[model samples]
Target: MSAPLASLPPRRLSWQFLRLVTPYWKSANKWQVRGYTLALLLFTLAQVALAIWMNYWSRELFDALEDKSLNDLLMQVGTFVLIFILTMAVTALHMQVKRWLQLDWRRWLTAKVLDQWMTRGHHYQLQLVGGEHDNPDGRIAEDIRIVTESSIGLVHSLVYSLLIFGSFVDILLTVTGSATFPGTAFMVPGYMVILAFAYAGAGTVFGLLLGRPLITATNKLQTAEADFRFGLGRSRSNSESIALMHGEDIERQNAKTFFARLSQRWNRQTLGYLGIVSFSSGYGALLPVFPILLMAPQYIAGGMTLGVLMQAAQAFQKLTSALSWPIDNLGELAHCRASIQRVLSLYNDMQVLDEQASEPQEHRISVAQSTQHELVLRDLCIANPDGLILLEGFNQVVRRGEHVLIAGDPTVTISLFKVVAGLWPWGHGEVWLPEGPAISFLPQRPFLPHASLQSVLSYPQPAEHFTQAAMHHALECAGIAWLAPRLTELDSWDRVLPLRAQQRLGFARLFLQQPAWVFIEEATDAFDPKGEEGMMDMLYRELPNATLLTISFHTGLERHYQRKLLLNRPAQDKYLTCSTSECSLTTAPVTPVVTAAD
Candidate 1:
C-alpha cells in the first residue's frame, strides 16, 4: 500500500519527485530540452521587466493627470500601448515554449513507464502480487499526463512568484518609505514589505488549515475515478461474454455501484474545496484595497502624491501575491501530489519484483538457464499465492523432441505451467530451462490484439517479418485460411472471429514461428472431439522434431504423447518430510508418471 500524500513530509516527496524526473534532464535529448527551458525562463524574465516598466508608467500617467497636462498624458498612454504589445508577445512565446517542454517530457516519461510495466512480463507478476497500483492503464494514460503538465506549470508559477517578489519588494519599500510608531520614536524601515510578508504568512497558515482535508479527498477521488474507468473497460473488453451470459443486469448494477462510489468521493472533494475557495475569494477581494487603505493616511495628509500612493498599492499587491504562491495554488498542488504518489507507488512495486528476482529466497521456485537440451524440474513444490500447497515433491525431466502431456487437477497443472514460464514463484523448487529459443505458451483463448489479421497472426513480431505465402500457408494448416483474404484488413479479430477460429489462429502463429518447444494449455479445448483430434494430428505432423507439453481435461490425449504426468494430492497417512533443498512425502510420489508407450 502507498502512504497517504498528507503523511509524507515535503522533503521526502520532493526527493521522490526528483528521482522520477531527473532521468529526462540527463537523457539523450537533454540539450534540446534544456535549450527550450532556458528560453522559457528568459521570456518570464522579460515579462517581469515589462511589468516594472508598466508600474513606473502608471505613476507618471497619474502625476500627469494631477497636473492636467495633455502632452504628458499622451506620452504615458503611448508607453502603455507599447508595454501591452510587448507583454502579449512575450506571454505568447512563453506559453509555446512551456507547452513544448510539457509534451516532450510527457512523451519520454510515458515511454519509460510503459517499458517498465511491459518488459519481462512484469504486468502479469504485478497482478499476482497485489498492491495499490490498480488500473495501471489509467495511471499510464491520465496520471502521467497530469504529473508532467501540472509539474511544469507549478514550477513555472513558483519561479515567476519568486522573481515577482524580488522585483516588487524594492519598489514597494521605496514608494511607501518608513513608518514611525504612533507614540514612540522607533521607526520601521520598509514598512509595506514587512506588512506584506506578515499578511501572506498569516494567510498561508489559515489556508493550510482549511485545505489539509483536500489532499486525502483528492487521492480518494482519483482512486475512485480509476476504479470506475477500470470497471467500464473490463466490461467493454468482455462485452461478448457478458451478452452471451445475459449478464447485463449484473454489469449495469456494477457500473452504478462504481459511479456511486465516485459520487461519494466527488462530494467529499467538493466539501474539502469549499473552505479553500471561500477563503481565497475573500483574500483576493481584499488584496487591491488593503494596501490603499493603509497608505491613504499619508496621501490625504499631503505627504504622499497620488501617483506614489497608487504605485505603492500596486507594488504591495505584487509582493503579497508572490509571497502567497503556496496558498494560491493549494488545490493544484494537491492534485499534482496525488498523481506523483500514485505513479511512484506503481514504480516502487515493480522495483520490488526486480529485487525479488535478483535475490531468490528459500520459499520461492528458482528458475535458471542451463546448457542441457532438456527441461528439468527437481524436488518441485507448487503453491498458490496464499501459501496453500497445490503440488508437492514433483520431479520431471523432459528431453528435447519429447511429447509430454501434463494431466490431472487443472489448478496444479496451471500453477506448474506458470512456474515453468517464470511467471509464478510462490513455492520451493528449481526449474532449469534449456538454452535455446523462447518457449511459446499458447493459452486456451489466445489474445488477439485489435489490428490487421497479418499483424495479429505475427504478434510480438512485425507483420513484414513473414512472407505473405508463409502466412497464408500457416493459416491454411490451422484451418483459418479463409481469413487470409482479409489479412490486410484491420479490425478487432477477437470480436469478429469465433472461439474455434481464434484458437486456430493461435495454432497458425505457432506454425509460422515453428518454435522448438511448445506448451499448450487447452488451446484446442473449444473444439469438438473430431476437431481436437485433427488439431493434435496437424500439430504432430507439422512439427515432428519439436518438443510438446500440453495440459487438457479431454481423454484419449494420452495416445498423442509418449508420457503422461498425473497431478494428485499426497496421501494423509504418509507424513510430510522437509529439508532445505527438498520437501517430499515419506511415501511414494504424489505425481505419478504413466508411460503411454507401454
Candidate 2:
C-alpha cells in the first residue's frame, strides 16, 4: 500500500500547504479577492470594537444593579439594544464577504488544477503508469473544496482571535494591576496576561500530543471513503452483467469489504476525537470560574466594584481563548493538513508528467511531418512497456491513393498502428507523414462520448460542421441508416448501442469525416463477411482517392487491397541482424513466398 499523506514531516507539509494557497493571491482574480478580504477585515474590526464595548457595558450594568440605580440600569439596557443591532449587521456582512472570497478562490484553484491535469494527455499517462495520485477526480472534486473552505475558515478565525486578543489584553492588564512575588521583591506587570499565556500554552502542548495520530487517521479515512465510492460506482456501471451472471452475492461481498475498511478507519478517527474531547471539556469548564476565583478576593474586600470584577473576568477569558486558538482547532488543523497534502501531491505529479511529456526521449519513436504525399516508416522498432521487442527494424511506405493490408500477430499489429498514430511513442526509428493531410484512425473498440447522436458522430468536431443530409448519407453507407433520424437524441451511446452498431457508427463517422488517409486496426471485426464486404465497397466508392491502411487477420478483404505487408518473427540471428544493420529488411520470409493477403 502507498504511504499515507500524514507521513510527511511538519515542515514539508507546511511548505506544501503554502504552495497550494499562495497561487490564488497571485492569480488573475487577486484584485477582486483583495477587495473582498479588505471588506471582511474592516467588518471584523467593527465587530471587535462592539465586543469591547459590550465587555465594558457588562461591568456598568452590574454596578448599576449593585447601587440599586433603576435609571442607570434602563439607560444601559437601551445602549445594549443599539450595540446588538450594529453587531448583527456587521456580522452578516462579514460572513457574506468571506464567503465570496472563498468562492472566488476555489474557482481559480480548481481551474488551475484542471488545466494542468488535462494538458498534454497527463491524465492518460497517469493511468498508464499507475502513479501515486490515486483518484484525480476526488482530488479535484473533493480535496480542492476542503482546502479552500478550511483555509478561509482558518484565516478568518485567526484574524478574529488576534483582534479580540489585542482589544482585551490592555484592559486585562489595567484591571489586574501589578503583582509582587510573595517572598521576593520581583514584580510583574500585566500578570493576568502572563498567567493566561502560560495556561493556554500548556493546553496547546497537551492538545498537540493527543492529536498527533489524528492526521494519519484522517488520511486513512479519506482513502477508505474513496475506495468505497469507487466500488459502488463500478457495481452500478456493471449492474447488467452482474445480474445476468447472478453474481449479486460476490458484488455484495466486495461492497461489504470496502465498507468494513472504511468503518475501521472511522472508528480509529473517533477514538482520537474521544481523547481530545476528554481533555478539552474539563479545560473549558474551568475557564469561567478560574478567572472569577482570582479576582473574587479583591471584590469581596471592597477594593473593586462588581463592574470592575466582571470586566476583568471577561477580558481574561478573551485573552486566553486567543492564546488557545491552536488547541481548540487541532482537529480542523489536522484535516486541513491532510487535504492540502493530497492536492499538492496531485499537482506535483501532474507537473512531473507534463515535463516528462515535453522532453524528448532517446528511446521514443521520432515522428515528423513531411512535404511529400506519402506515409513512410524507416527502420521502425516497436517495443512493449517492459522493453520486449514486438517489431524489430521494420520499414514500410505507402503512397497516396494506395490500398494496403498489414497482417501479423494481433499484439504486434495493434502496437504498430498505435505507433503510427503517435499514441504509443516508446519505440525507435522515424515516421514521416504528408504535411497538413487529414488522417483518421478507427480502433477495434470505438469510443462514443456521452452526447447527442449528432455530436457523437462528429466527435472532435462540432455537430454544425456537417449537414443533416451528409450525416444521413454516411449512416446509409455504413449500414446504420436507422440512427440517422435520431441525430438530436442524447444518451450513453456506447452502452446503449450494441457492439456491432457501435462499430458501424465508427465507420459512419469515417465516411462523414472523409479524411485523405484512413488507418483501420481491426475495426471491422464485428461485422459478418457480407457486411464487411459491403462496408469496404462503400468506403472505396465514396473516397476513391483516399489512401487506406488496414490491419486484419481475415484474408477475405485482401482482394480489395493492391498490396500487403506481412510481419514475421524471424529467428534470433535474423532479428539481431535486423536490429544492428538495416540490411535484413524484407517483406517475405527467406525460404517461402507469402503475402499478408494470402
Candidate 3:
C-alpha cells in the first residue's frame, strides 16, 4: 500500500494485480476484449494525429497574428474552426466508445469477481474467516470505478503528450538550425533537445521537492475517507437500535468530528492543487515570449520568415508539455498507482488464503457430486478457524430418506451440517452429494431478502420462478396462511417481520419444496415445546420419504430422530463411539458431557 513511493517494488504493484486481471482475458469472451483493445489502439492513433494538427494550428495562428495579413487571417480562421469542430466531434465520439468499453469491462469484472466469490461458497466462508477483507461489493463497485475511469484518462494523457513531443521536435530542431558552439560545423540541432530536457528536468525536481509529499498525503487521506464512509454506513444500518437507545447525538458528534478531518485534508489538497496550477500557469505565460526572444532577431535579420519564428514558439511550448508529463498529470498518476496497489494487495490476500486452506495443517476440503444414490462422506474431518478438528476420520452413509439427528454441542454439529450441505468447505473433507441436488437449508437466522412474500418464500429467486399454488401451500402448511394475502406485496421483510414468523415461513418453504435432503440448524428452537412438537409433526406429515438432518444442542430433540451422531472440538478430549441404548458421555441431567471415556 506504500503507493506514494516513486518506485514501487515491481513484485508488489502490477505483478499480483495483473494475476487477478489475467482470468478475465482468459475467459471465453476474450475475443471481445481483444477487439476492444484493438479499437483503443486505433483511437489512440487518431488522437495523436489530432495533437499534431493542434501544433500545426498553433504555429499557423501565431504567424498570421505577427504578419497582420487580412486574407491569411481569414484563411487561418476558417481552418481553425474546421479543425476545432473536428476535435470536439472526435472527443465526443471517443467518450462514447470508451463508455461502451467501460460497461463491458465492468460487466466482465463483476461477473468474474462474483463467480469466484460465490464459486466455492467463498462469500459465505469469508464472513466466518479472514476473508472479511474480500469486500467483493466494494471491489465491484468503487474499486472498479476508480480503476476503469482513471485508466482511460491516464491513457489519453500519455498519448497526447507523446504525439505533441513527436510533432514539435521538427519545429524545435528547425529553429535551432544547428548549435555553432564557438567553432563547429553545426551539431545537428541537438542543442534544442538539450534545452527542452533541462527545462523539464528542473521543473520536475523543484515541483517534487515542494509537492511530492502531497501524493503520499493523498493516499493516506483516501484510506481514511473510505474508513469513515464505512463507519457511517454501519451506523445507518443500525439506525433502529441507535434511535431506540437515543444514540443519535453521539453518532452526530462522531460524524461531525470525522467530516471535520475530511475537510481539513480537502483544504490541504486544494493548497497542493493551487501550487501546481501556479507553477504550470507561470510556465505557460513565459512560453510565447521565450521563443520570440530566441528567434525574433534571426527572423528580422532574414534568417527565417515570420512564419518560421512563430512555428518555433509553438514547437517550444509543445515540447515543454511533453517534458512536463509528471507535473501535468500528478493527481491522476497518484490516484492510479494507489488504486492499482490496493487491487494488488487484495489479489495477494486471496492467494495466501488459497495456499493456507490447501496446506496439510488445515486439511484441504474437496467437494464432488454423489455418483450413486446416496449422500456420503469419506474420511471427513471438519475443523475450526484455529485448526480445531471437530469431526475426524469420519465415514457416514446418508440414505435417501433417513431423518438423522446430529446431537452434539450446537456450534460444531451445525458446522458439520453446513459441511454436508456443501456450504462450508474450509476443513479437510470430501462431501459427496447426489447430482442435481435439491436442498432446503434452515439456519438459526434464516435469510429473508427484501421482496414480496412470494419472493421471500422463494428466497434466492423471483416469485415468478415458482408457481403461486406452491408458495400458497407452503405458507398454509407452515401455519402462516395469513401471509397468503401479502404474497404480492413487496417490502423489507427482514425489518418488518419477527424472527419466529420468518422461521415459520422457512418451514413453509421446506414443506412446499419437499427437497430430498432438508438441513436444519437449530431452526425449530424458535417455537415453544408444544409448537416444536406440532411443527415436527407437520414436517413428517408433508415429507414422509424425505431425509431430515437436524443440528441441535437440546437433547430433547434426540427422541424425534432414528439416528444420532455426536461431535466435539479438536483441542479437547478424544472422540469415542457411543450407542443409543446407554451412553457414559452424558452425566448432567440436561447437559451432555462428551469425553474419550465412553
lDDT of 2 by residue, 1-598 (tens): 1244456788977887677678777777678777888898899889889989999999999999999999999999999999999989998998899888877888888998989888755666566554458778888888888888888899888998999988899899888887666689998888888888888888889988887778779888988898898888889877767878999999999999999999999999998888778889988998998888977776887868999989999999999999889989888988887778778878888776554444454446777788999999887766654445567767777899899998867777887787777766555678898766657899997889999999999997999999999999999988899998899999989777877899999999988988899999898898899989988999999889999999998989989999888775434322212232232323432321225442
What does candidate 3's lDDT look like per residue over 526-591, in tens digits? 788787878888898999988888877666666678777776554454332223332222121122
Clashes of 2: 0
Worst 10 residues of 2 by lDDT: 573-582
Candidate 2 regions with alpha-carbon error over 4 angstroms: 1-6, 180-187, 366-368, 378-392, 425-429, 565-598
Looking at candidate 3, what is the lDDT of residue 317?
70
Please report the candidate that would top TM-score against the real structure: 1
> All models: lDDT?
0.87, 0.82, 0.70
In candidate 1 the C-alpha lDDT for residue 275 amounts to 96
> Which of candidates 2 and 3 is the stronger one according to TM-score?
2
In candidate 1, clashing pairs total: 0
- Compose the digit string of candidate 1's lDDT tens values, residues 172-223: 8788889888889999999889999998998899999999999889989999
Q: Please report the TM-score between candidate 1 and the true structure.
A: 0.94
TM-score of every model? Answer: 0.94, 0.88, 0.84
Structural RMSD, model 3: 6.2
